[model samples]
Target: MAKLVQFDRLGGPEVLTLRDVEVRAPGAGEVRIRVDAIGLNRAEIMYREGSYFDRPVFPSMLGYEAAGVVEAVGEGVDGLAEGDPVAVVPAFLQSAYGTYGDHVVVPAAAVVPRPAGIGPVPAAAVWMAYITAYGPLVEAGQVRPGDHVLITAASSSVGLAAIQTARHIGAIPIATTRGAAKRQRLLDAGAAHVIVTDDEDLPARVKEITGGAGVRLAFDPVAGPGVEAIAQGIAPGGTLVVYGALDPRPTPLPNAHSYPALTSRTYTLFEITKDPERLRRAVAFVNAGLASGSFTPVVDRTFDLGDIVEAHRYMQAGDQVGKIVVTVTHDAASD
Candidate 1:
């Protein structure tokens, strides 16, 4: 039997329950992994609250990313075998292949070999953040040297990924947080400028930072009344990519109506998974970045599997500076 995290109803972290489940052999084209570490994401929180894009069924299994070792490979799967270390990408349906468990069955195609010297914790932290940022900022936006990129919710994993990606591409990364607490941390993480949204006006500071031309791109996860301020900081004809809705309120388009020429789009990793060529490119780009040390996964804290509820509570508090991960212990050897 393997332990899994599941919830019966839509609600807060308190709704989550850990239960022992039967472990089964993988079906064709699937692999059974002995999970070592699981990455926590805000999307899971939204999913738990019943506000995310995908609706959850009753007794829903909720997780997207994890790092583990292959204990068994299903028939028709190639190039993977028992005892191989791998990271499960966020390319599977959460309802069918959730990773918040001691063992998980996932599509073999969604599994990527873990790089040498990277531990399970860091491997679990890489895929979602880096790939999410790479899709819009580098692949679609065509970010270049001298471009100014604005990143909101700058202390989150994806925000930090955007900051690193912008700097790696020679663009100036401007990070924004809710208050002064994470300003220096953002700077130290390679943000060229930091904006404390509660203290400084986002549009004003962005304009000042960009010498009145405003930012070329704005990567926002928090979409609410504050979206107007984010849109106001975009350069004429620049793009504003809203990815996650951390705020519960509806996003207003006041600036979009006023600045008709500006490009405003919603971004989701599901789109990347749909395009084979794009997914190939994104995977290659992130792999190179990780191997070259240009991209680093920042883990704010780690919790044991028993502390799942506390981990979710900490994530809800919104004070973490990077990724939150849950470590799972198993008898099998981890490569």
Candidate 2:
């Protein structure tokens, strides 16, 4: 039996509860991971609230990122063994294979050997944010050196990752936040310019920062009427990649009909994860960045696994500047 987080009916963080259940042995092409650290994402909150892409089944476990020791491997699994330290990539759907547990079994292909010297907490935080940023910025956008890139919601873990990823390619990252409180923190995280959306005119400031050329690429998670302002901030012929829908309002695409040759594409993290070749390239790029010290996950704070309710609540509060992590004590591993 293993301790896993489950929610019967969806509502809020209050719905999450820990329960002990029989953990099945690994099947073909699967591995059992004794998770030590779990990363918290706003998507988890959306899933809990029944607003995510996949509706949660009652008594559902929902998570997609973790790091831990490999406890066992199943038939046909290669290059992995018992006791190997590994990071769980967000390659699978949370509704299909949740990581929010002390002990969980997942597909072998979804596990990456954790880099040496990267502890569980940082490893747990790495894959989802970095890969999410990497797909749109590097692979799809094909951002070039010295190009200006706009990152909305600049204080998010994915936002910070986009900053570093842009810098990794010598591109200039212009980060945008709704308030001024996280400006310095975003700069510290490698954003070249930080914009306070509430206080400054977004397109005007972006134009001023880019010398009227405007940003060549924009990465945005919040898709709504606000996208019109973001669209106004992009250079002609530039690309806007929308990866999420934080705002429930209707998204207006000024660039599609009103602007000059501006391109807009809707993206999801699954674009890379679901493609074998893309996933391979992403893993290589991120692994190289990690090994060279160009990429490091910024963990804003941590909570005990038992305090997951607080973690979820904190995520909903949106006060954190980076990833919020959860550490498992494993006292219930024996359950």
Candidate 3:
């Protein structure tokens, strides 16, 4: 039997419950992993709250990131063996294969070897955040050295990853947060500049920071009326990649009334992860960054598997500065 989290009704974090169930062995092209850590994401919360892009089925399991050791591999699986340390990427739909469990069977393509020295907790936090950021900044936006990039909601795991990723490429990352509490932390986390949205005007401040030139690239997850402000701060020919819907309201595009020629597009991490060539390039790039010490996963807090409810509450509070991870334990020990 394996322990996993599931919820029949949607509404809040309280809906999540831990239960024991039989975990079937991996089938063809599948890999079963003894999950040691699970990463928390906003998408999970949105899914639980009935606000996600995909509607949930009753008694649904929802998760996308985890790190563990491979326990078995099915037919056609190659390059992986029992006892190998691996991390699951957020390549598939959460409804299809959730990772919030002690053991899970996932498509082999979603599994990647965990880099040496990156333990389960950090490993669980890596792919989703970095890849989400990478899709917009490096792959699509083509951010380059010295390019000024604006990152909104800059304290979330993905936002912080954008900061690190921009720094790795020699780009200037200007981070934005809802309040002043996270300003220093965002700066400490490598943001070239921090903007506290509550006090300052986003468009005005960004324009001032860029000497009226505006940023070369703007990465935003929150869309709504606020997106127009972000669009106003982007340079002509610059790109604003919207990857999420933190703001539930309808997002407004740049109006024709004296607006700059800013290009805006909706992007999802799947755009890169779903394509074989793009996924290969993304994985190789991230691996190189990790090997060279240019990229590091930041963990805000960790909770034991039993404390998942409290962890979700904390995430909903929106005060976290980085990734929240849940650790799992087994009675038997292995080398």
Candidate 4:
């Protein structure tokens, strides 16, 4: 048997329960992984709270990303073997193959070979955050040299990824958070400028940062009544790509009288599934960045599988500077 996380009903972090489950062998086209680490994401929290795009069935499994060694490979699987290190991508349905367990079975296609020199914690942390940021900034926005990109929720793993990605492409990344505490952290994380939203006027600061022309793109995850303020900061013909809803309030439409002819768009990583070429490009870009040390996965804290509820609570507290990870132990001898 292996330990796993599950929830019988929708609610908060308290709903998550750790339980022992039987380990089943992988079937056709599936691989069984002995999970070493799991990446905690806000998507899982939303799914647990019944606010995600997909609703959970009763007693549902809930996770998307993990890193581990392959224990076994099913029939017709190729290029993978037992004892190989791999990372599970967020491409599968959570209801079908959740990774918050000591042992998980997922489609072979969803497994990527762990990059060289990266530990299990970083392997679990890289895919979701980087890929989510990559789709909007690199693919859709086509961010170019000298572009000014605004990143909201600058302390999130995805937000940090955007900062690094923009810098990698020779663009100026402006990071925004709710207070001054994360200001220096964002600057150290590769942001050209940091905006404290609670104390600063967003549009005015953005205009000053760009010398009155305004930013070329705004990557926002917190879409609420303040969206119009973000819209006002965009340069004419610039785009605002929103990928999450951290705010509970409804997203208000941009003011019609606003200048700059801004375009508002919604993006999700799911689009990569429909376009294999884009996924290929994104993976190549991220892998290159990882190998060169241009992109680093920042893990704020790690918890044992037994402390998952506490991990969730910490994630919900909104104080973490980066990703939160949960390490799994299959045997008492392992740390």
lDDT by residue for model 1 (100-174), tens: 999889988888889888999999999899989998899889988999999999999999999999988999999
Checking candidate 1 for backbone clashes, the offending pairs are: none
lDDT of 4: 0.90
Which segments of model 2 are wrong by more than 4 Å? 332-335
Candidate 3, residues 41-133, lDDT tens digits: the string is 999999999888877886788899999999999999999999999999988887778999898999898999998888999999999999998
- Mark the regions of model 1 whose C-alpha exceeds 4 Å error after superposition: 254-257, 331-335
Clash pairs, model 2 backbone: none
Where does candidate 3 have its weakest 10-residue lDDT segment?
A: 326-335
Candidate 2 local lDDT, 1-335, one digit each (tens): 78899999989899999998899899999999999999988889999998898888778998989999999999999999999999988878777789999899998988989988999999999999999999988988899999999999989999999999999999999999989989999988898899999999999999999999989999999999998888888999999899999999988876456555788889888888878788889989998898899999999999998898999999999999999999999765373
Compute the lDDT for candidate 3.
0.91
Off by over 4 Å in 4: 332-335
Residue-wise C-alpha lDDT for candidate 4, range 1-335, written one tens digit per residue: 87889999999999999988888999999999999999999999999998998889868898988999999999999989999999988887776779998998988878888999999999999988999988878888898999999999989999999998998889999999999999999988999999999999999999999999999999999998878899989999899888899988999777558666888888888787436577778889999999988899989999999999999999999999989999986776631
Better of 1 and 2 by TM-score: 2
Model 3, which residues run further than 4 Å from truth?
A: 333-335
For candidate 4, what's the RMSD?
Answer: 1.6
> Estimated TM-score per prediction?
0.96, 0.97, 0.97, 0.96
Q: What is the lDDT of residue 33 in candidate 2?
A: 96
Model 1 gets an lDDT of 0.90
